[model samples]
Target: MAAPDELFCWEGAWGLPSVSSDCLTVLAYAQFAGAPLKLRKISNPWRSPSGSLPALRTNQNETLSRPADIIIHLRKQKFNADYDLSAREGADSLAFISLLEERLKPALIYNSWVDSKNYVEVTRRWYAEHLPFPLNFLLPGRMQRQQLETLRLLRGEESLEGGEELEKELYREASDCMNLLSQRLGARKFFFRDSPSSLDAYVFAYLAPLLKAKLPNGKLQQHLKSLENLSSFCSNILLLYFPHDARESSGGQKSSSPPQPEGGDYDHVPNKRRKQLMSVLVALGAMLSYAVLTGILSIQHMQKEALEAPPPDRQTLDPLDEDEEGDG
Candidate 1:
């Protein structure tokens, strides 16, 4: 028997199995196709062989990072979610997925990364809390930068300046896309009426995050919730395919405490004490380095001070010895 492929992906949060839309797409597709995989849920992307999340390490030793490439590779292994899709259905799938990318993706990026409130409170805080030490200090900001760049590219602009005008345009297109999807999915259990397909995976990935996340600024989320069918669609998929995560999400909501980091699987506070120690050490080292670099505290200066200090009172020691002889 061949060894199962290993999938490294972002840890789940917000009751969704993986916070990343791309990772959710791949995961849902794999589940729909019945592909057996060893899942390695991780908060740190650097742990993945490809140095990114949603990476696949095949039994053949090939590592794939992009979700599209990973899906293509899975199809080659006869794990195809779209195998049952009719020719017209397949064409429709491509069209709708394209529509989502062109219309909805920019909005998702904006709300998650470019929107100041959501980025600071929900998105950045989630990753920063879940990510292991040192990286926790750096990667969230870097990821935001990358997401912003991606959003700019999607908008076909050399640079993006967030404003009320830009927000209105993005939300308008996103709402239009959601309405279209809801109309197409009117009363069906799945996009194709019965069986799940890649289209289902794609739509679910995009909508689930927006629906489930507790964003401070949730204009898109409110619109999605108003579309009853689309909201049910995401909920149904979560219950059917990802029951464990669904349970976790429900449990988290009922509790008074804040949601724990990634469900005790990925950096789940097992190394929290160690990370705290390392964080303190790193902070101290940084402070010491800064002091030395700025000439505030110098090793050579301390050494010179020690060397120039007056010798201890040899006469004082001799007086104690002389007093002892007199007593004798």
Candidate 2:
């Protein structure tokens, strides 16, 4: 067969470590589309849209500089009417995009909180900052630091505190997403109603990092092992597109064993529980403040009425009677 059409050619880092999951999802979709994908290394990791390096160039001669924009462009192209993209397939793609946006937001907020800086500073610190030692050379180390730092900031701790909570939340959300996919997929091998669609690629891409993540505790690892299909999809994609790296990473292990999926009583909580809790707390605080203000207002109103009411008419009759008696 002739070489498949190349859809995405990325340079340097397509997505920052904070959102690499999304980056992987993008790649998975491209690969699933039977599009040849390649990554060209750049001397500077911090190259921005205005920078000289071209991050993405499609077969159509279109160039995209940002990861978000790149995904958007891909969706529009792949799902275009002329492309005959299926409705169900398009919905999956949209869902992937939505999940990615949700995942990236907190990371952005965490970066801002740590640096108290604008988007540029946060993005630069995340993608371009140099790390110490051998870790500086490894992609995982570079990516890990940014992720850890963001998590630290989010937890408001000096170190990677609250990662448990963060990880839990991530797992919950991802599981919910995956669960939806599982239902749709049922016994089918792919996400598309009939055949494997671009959605599978996106889902796999976003999930790769999680599959590769070296969790300190067995929690996340165990959680991942539970999603058999997701695990299978990730492993299959890694083998196909990144065989050498996958081999080296897998260490010649022949077993079809998936990583032990993390499990706990905590994982089953609603995915957005933390967000909901925060909203409830905010509402409660606002209501309390309003109640206090109303109480103060009521007291002030009563005091004003007491002060303004005409003084009871003074009894002047006694003085008049005294004067009349004196006259008599």
Candidate 3:
């Protein structure tokens, strides 16, 4: 038997299997397809083979970073969840997925990273606490910037001056998308019938975080809760395929580990040691850079202040010299 492909994804928090939507998407798709995957839940992306979350390391030793590419690879390996879908259903799935990316994604990003209250109180705090020390200081801010850029690109704007107007627009579009999805799902156990498919995976991933996370400004979450079907849909997926995650999210302790990969626990010791070494080296480097930068800025600021200061009073010194002459 071949070793299961290894999936490197963000660590679960706030009760989801992973905090990242992209990671959740791939994880759900893999589960739906029955792909044998060794899950490595991590806070630091640098530990992953591709230096990114949601990376898949195949049996052939190839690394795939994108969720779409990982799904395609799984399908090629004969683990396709979408294989049972009819042509029309497949088309509908594609259309709905596209709609999700355009309409729902920006608001998700905004709620997670751009919305000040949620970002500060929830999103940033979660990452900062979970991530390794120096990375805790860096990656959350970097991730926020990337999400903001993604929002700008999605809106086809040079920049997004996020305010009430922008938030209103994003929330409105997302709410409408959720309503449409609720109408389409309409009590169906899964999106495409009894069995889950790629669309179910995408929908579950996109909605689960919003449903599960405790955002400070929860306008979209409020709207989602009002649409009971959509809320139930996310809950059903959690209870069905991800019971462990559901339990953890609902405040229960994790009683057991997810299934392990082919190797024995001892086999990973060397790799674990290596990752620790790398983390230490990276932390040291980051600290060194910060120190050097701080010192340089301090020196420059002092130089500027010195140049701006008035010359010392020579007249006062002359008075002291005359007093010495008079005493002589």
Candidate 4:
């Protein structure tokens, strides 16, 4: 396989050179396509035209930023790894990709950022390891806010200030998308059956980290574990293609060993997160209104006092009110 000119992306974590899902998506395609990609890790997203990672500069000096665009460019250049699907199958693939992109992406953001436990333990730590100190501090938070904003905009909502309901809805939507993918894959060797498609790369990219990471919330992890075929599908892919990482993860074992939870010791934490978001927002608005009203009333009272009272020296001092009882 001829080497790629260069691929620019965020550095990896968990003993990887490129740990990001998007970065891995691109790498996985290149692998399946027999494209030899040389990775160039970048700390700053500004290095790319879209201010994002996983940008590729091809042998012909064409710069592509997005995964779909990169794959299209590769196909056009006759390095064709893209599935030559029938019109119906192609449409189906496109729909599935959109589902993963729009719905699944936000769920990932929730796992990494909104989930307090995952953010502190896994996501933040991973990003911090790859970034400079201050940037490590700022970037994770900035990413969280940006993803939250994106979710808000996608849902056609105004603010994420009281977004618990939205967050819950997003989680459900993501889970549904996952289940749909699982059903579609449905014991097939690959989504396209024996011939891997670009969607397979995306599947591996998104699931790899979540499945492996020892996160605190464990909801996302648990949800993934529930999908038996999906788990096997991911494991099988790594064992077949990425034998090194797969073998290392399995302690030098050639085959993929799906990690098992011991003896039904899983925590079924009741999602106590309530649906009182609207109430909370309304309460806050009321408090703000009360504060404004109080301020206005206070100003009016001050004005009345000023009008009713004479200047101190000119006023007759009431004996009952005089503190010192001076010369009574």
lDDT tens digits, residues 151-206, model 3?
A: 88988864687588899999999999999999999978898878999999999999
- Where is model 2 more than 4 Å wrong at Cα? 1-19, 36-38, 42-44, 47-54, 57-63, 72-84, 103-170, 193-195, 251-328
Task: Report the lDDT of model 1 for residue 155.
Answer: 88
Following a full C-alpha superposition, what root-mean-square deviation does model 1 have from the true structure? 10.8
lDDT tens per residue, model 2, 1-328: 4332232222212122123444454555555554445554343434423332334666565567665566557566553221445666577567765764565334333333322232233333333333222333564344546665666564455564444565456556655666665565566566555444556655565555545643333343455577787777667667776566676555533432253243342333333677578679989999999998989867766776788653344246666888999999
Q: In terms of lDDT, which candidate is stronger, 1 or 4?
A: 1
TM-score of 2: 0.48
What is the TM-score of each predicted model, taking all chains together?
Answer: 0.82, 0.48, 0.77, 0.69
Ten residues in sequence with the least summed lDDT for candidate 2? 9-18
lDDT agreement of model 3 with the native: 0.88
lDDT sort, best first: 1, 3, 4, 2
Which ranges in model 4 have alpha carbons more than 4 Å from their true place?
Answer: 1-3, 14-17, 41-51, 251-328
Give the CA lDDT, 0 to 100, for residue 68 in model 3. 92
Question: Pick by TM-score: which candidate is best?
Answer: 1
Error of 2 at 64 (Å): 2.3
Root-mean-square deviation of every model: 10.8, 19.8, 12.3, 14.2
Candidate of highest lDDT: 1
The residue pairs found clashing in candidate 1 are none
**Higher-lDDT candidate of 1 and 2:** 1
Q: Lowest summed lDDT over 10 consecutive residues: which window, candidate 4?
A: 263-272
